[model samples]
Target: MSALPTTATHEPEAPIISAVKSNASAENRVHGLKLAILLGSLTLVTFLSLLDTSIIGTAIPHITSEFHSLPDVGWYVGAYTLGAATLQPLSGKLYAYFPTKAVFMGFVFFFELGSLICGVAQSSTMLIIGRAVAGMGVSGIFNGAITVLSAAVGNEKSPLYFGIVLGTSQMGIVCGPLIGGALTEHASWRWCFYLNLPAGGLAVLILAFIHFPELAQKKTFSMALVRKVVPELDLIGFLLFVPPSVMFLLALQFGSGNTHAWNSATVVGLLVGSGVLAVIFILWERRMGDRAMLPGSLVKQRMVWVSCTYGMCNGCCMMIASNWMPTFFQAVKGEGPTLSGVHILPSILSQLSAVIVSGALISKLGYYLPWALGGGIIMAIGNGLVSTFTATTSVGQWIGYQIVVGAGRGAGLQAPLVAVQNAVKPSQVPIATAFLVFLQNFGVSIGIVLSNVAFTQTLTQAIPLYAPSVSSQAALDAGAGAGAVRDLVRGHEDELSGVLRAYSEGLRNIFYFLVGMSCIAVVLSLGMGWVDVRKKKDSTKSTGDNEAQEKKVEEKSLNEA
Candidate 1:
């Protein structure tokens, strides 16, 4: 087996000449234009995958009402997330075995098919299944984009491209809720899913015309060398890992409210089962070495571990804010869902600005550590300020605080990826990037569960305190049933105002917990080593030269002996 091409051997400016020398420059220009088109198309595909998550969140209430179940509603989100998480590790395997273009294009088809199914879903179960399928497709799309982008630009330019790709994806997330809300209000909630069809179709058309040399040819895996060069897909790992993750998520979504208690046997059983399965899976992976779904040695690296942790923490904070802010506006601030979605505009804009500015600055300055630290601090402060939110708080105040939080999140989001990519050997970049994303998604799931638990507990306690005269039965009825509490308050506006105040206070209390989480993330950000993205090309050149020199000395000494 021959070694892969290195940065030292690959020249960016090597020109290609066809039979006619007169047309060489024209050919090069055409090639550059095609490359730009390819990047744009791939970026759009990546954006679509991320857009689905946030876009659907704003429409959760509509879906729940149509399906007639709140308990099962979380699955609308969870199903997609579970499928994405389960398939993430396999992306690397698919990339290694198939043409990158084929793998990406195949996943896009799956994603489109799933979206079509979701748009016309007649029941909650069908929607959940559609979401899961979509997730399975999405799991590979963004990872494939990152892999292709890295290959296109080489390692020296990867950080800038990584930042650009990530920034674009985050923009999709920011736009999703607003777009979903507009479509759901003026058109139909179904259009939220239907909208992806045209966007995805256009992306497919664009990509077809844009050629990717890296994915132009497919490679076959040899059975004899498979165990040594690439580990077989760990079916057993999937079986063990997927169930526990699902069970754990189920327990979180269902073990609260009237369904089950925190200490109930069903909840306990699921929790314990998940823990045991996770332990067994880890042990199994340790024994398998290179064959593990998550290679232990790679994870043990300091940079990898810290990057995963930071990613998880950042994910948790972002998920909590994204999920709860709309609820807060609707429940306590007396804003309609559509209005609430609009209110988040400032946060979204700020996040977008931060992402673009951060990318450009990292590309120019080359240092990412200071930005990471500053971002963490901003996030903590923004969250802490939000803890003071009250029913009387003005929209301007709310949006301002949210923008601050958004800036913090945006600034910190890309730094870890840049740091981790810089730390590892080029061969490990795909796996490392996938692992970081996986951890972040895992964190989002965990955050939703924990925040849901906190909100439920706080509301339950506060409702009774503010509405002592209301019968326990009425309070319970209002708490468990949708629109019940809102109706109750509307009927007795004077008395329920106090109850609304209490609910707002309870929600604010949860923000305190979020602030604490951000602070912990701040401490962790300090541990991520510094790297200068601006000087990355020069640095890599020097390092490669030193390595080549060392190899030459060893060769000369061997010949003399």
Candidate 2:
């Protein structure tokens, strides 16, 4: 009656969190103080990297003031996403094939470099470039954090650890707006980026003292090794992947409703070129087979597809809302950047709480599907409710809507990763993790561009009806920041209210799209299948039998001695 295969994917092994690894003895494990520092540093790295993504959200108004470009909002906001998405597969493979600690530290160097660049950047384009570099490092760090954490605490307990780490680091991401706002208002917008340098530097310093799982089996990076490493990293495959990806995302950024007409040469040409490149990539990957950056066999798995889709949908809903919510507070509510960031805290805190609780529930119950399924339904309701928000929306209504939306997003954020990790072999886990991360970034990138498209398209029509004296372009320009909006309608109260309502309508359309994506996520989540993580590897060892395990370990250690 069920499609579940009993013997293939689910290989039996004794649960090993409290037991010796099947590969190495108990002595190889790092515990106590050193372990705490390792995990804390890893979480810190993650926090700083993710903080960059949102820290700029509230600071954007300040940023736009200096740059004077509003249409490039997607460029500034998603530049890091572009880098994160592009480097994902390679980042995963690097962790898989190289020494983990060394590669992680290397990524930290590059991430810090990007932060330094952003702090000193003079133009919007330069800032976007810096963000892209930082994003590249974030990609490796994300994959490495998961891989390294799993090795530290066996796969059996990884879900809980991941929850702890993600829950902790996510604080940086959601709170970035608050921190960025304060810094932007009091100090300078550059402080938002400058903040990462010292914090990330300290995290790297702590990491240098620790040992990693991959280091125990280190290989010299000789010329012969380079020959193997090049192919292993799938340099050619990524070369093909990068161009088409950039083309596709750029097309979305300039999509008809946002910048150019559907029939315009620029949009049409980019779409066609991107499609052709994508086809070539698929064909080349097919030829490369297992050696490809995206292996066909792994990519073809039902669970893998479902997980990637689910991750994409979850990211799409969450990221688009995050980007727009701050704008709502500033534009319609006429709040300062600091107050806007404060108002957005409900969503952030609720999302974090949901992730921590949901992760614990999944670990205890050994089921991720129910959370994924339920989260979608709740998220759909949340997004739909949020879509109803308007200029006159009350404080209670906004906060309540955000909490609901955040709960739904946080509940399902990592379900796909948990599901994929369970479905694949340990060796293939890095690849799967990379794939999931890629799709999540991809979804986020496209969602952000499209949200802008939806917002801009609605504003174009609404501005004419709402404020007859104001040109559509001028009103659109006014939305570059709240200051601009106030300046544009300073003389007329009626025009001000009209512009505010236009903003509400424009943001509403974005939520409508999110509602549809949430429903699709619900459908995709259903196909992740059902597997009890505990039963899959429950064998001779069980944490429930702790006394027996201690005695067995003691005897084994004595025998070796």
Candidate 3:
């Protein structure tokens, strides 16, 4: 709860440094072919970074079977998420202190290394480790891409570049399951990891040739500078934030099943430990002030906190739906993995389409709140309808329901970021943006864990009640996968009917949970203040002068950082 930092530093060199950067930036502005190449590389990296998050979902059953470790299903996704969340904040600091181009390529190399590990992993443990490493690499890609793009183009063109990258990454999310399914079915599941190699290599190669503008001060590295840069990176905040996050997510992942019950000592201990660590984290952040992961200075703003909360909810909806939809279709509808992925396209396409439309509308109207509220309502309705799905649910019903939720999600997903960015000073935008992205990704990790618990718990209880002859342990052993369930009940008509019904009900329970999440988003969206994106009407002279001033201020801030 410390007051936010003011732009009132007393450093003697600040003004001189700012003036030098202002002049140099104009000279280094990128254009033409070089600009296009930078954007294309950024778009590719963004796509691959996000692609890993959802691609594993369709292949989870295959991974589970190969390792004979059904209980470790959630870890496949959560492990990668843990790494991403842990390193997310630090990446922002790293960019501030190091050469952006070198740092970005280094992270990409790390990502590729991870994918290689996963592709060659012989055990479930190895795969999880690979995922964690890959997640660490992905953690930096999005932030780095944004920073590079912002520097590559002027303010007027930045939004369009960001939109193109965002849309492409989203399409990657939609295509992940399809790609995972195709690989797992026709090729080896390992191909999913190998797939990243060539595409990522091409991106890195392009980045190697394209130079981006960087603060001149960061080019020099010395032992003397280490002391100065270390505090700015805020390693203490990172250490405090990561443990509690890991504990909380692990507690949820282990909250059910034969080995770990809700009230078991392991679960109870982790829950209590997570709470204690969270309290410590808050205290630590309060002390760190501007250096905190969720910096107290920027977070004190109302828009910042509201946007963070909104991000958490949005992340939950996005990750849960993306990860679970393929599983649901295969299990309840008896579709193959490839076909199952295809079945969910209506929703993904609509969400992407809505995002495009939403951006245009918000740009014109200048207010994002209406879209946010409207999206929440529509999402809630969609989830409610989806909660009624059963084995007999028609194709039209599922597709229509998905379209509704997809549209809702797309409409409001970026609004919170817009609100926060507009509310902050130019200097605070980087940290503010990083903090929001961290919360959103953290929400994704939490959502996947919660969904796993709910789905497993429901299926565990319902399978026994619906089919008294089938053991709950038997169904549990089959895994939370359509193929697994089919294998278990194959040639047993009555058992198949009961197990399918149980699976359907379990999926419904998850949708119902999302309904509540969507409703909460609506309430949070209402709390967002009315901020217009449109430029205020002013005399031409004043408008030009203000633009010039703002540009200098932003560039100076970037240089100082």
TM-scores of the models, in the order given: 0.82, 0.87, 0.90
Across 318-415, the per-residue lDDT of candidate 2 in tens digits comes to 87788788888887777888888999999888998898799889989999999999999999999999999887899999999999999999999879
Q: What is the number of backbone collisions in each predicted candidate, taken in the order shown?
A: 3, 0, 0
Q: List the residue pairs that clash in candidate 1.
A: 366-532, 366-533, 366-534
User: Candidate 2, 360: how far from true, in Å?
Assistant: 2.4
Which of the two, 2 or 3, has more TM-score?
Answer: 3
Residue 60 of model 2, lDDT score: 76
lDDT of prediction 1: 0.72
Model 2, 186: alpha-carbon shift in Å? 1.7
Q: Write the per-residue lDDT of candidate 1 for residues 334-448, one digit (tens) a residue.
A: 5655776787777777876887788679878888788788888998999888878887888789989999998998888778888888878886777788888777766666666
Per-residue lDDT, model 1, residue 320, is 68
Model 3 misplacement above 4 A: 1-24, 215-219, 535-561
Best by TM-score: 3
Residue-pair clashes, model 1: 3
Candidates ranked by lDDT: 3, 2, 1
Candidate 2 pairs with clashing backbones: none
Write down the lDDT of every candidate, Cα atoms only. 0.72, 0.80, 0.80
For model 3 the local lDDT of residue 228 reads 58
lDDT of 1 at 192: 82
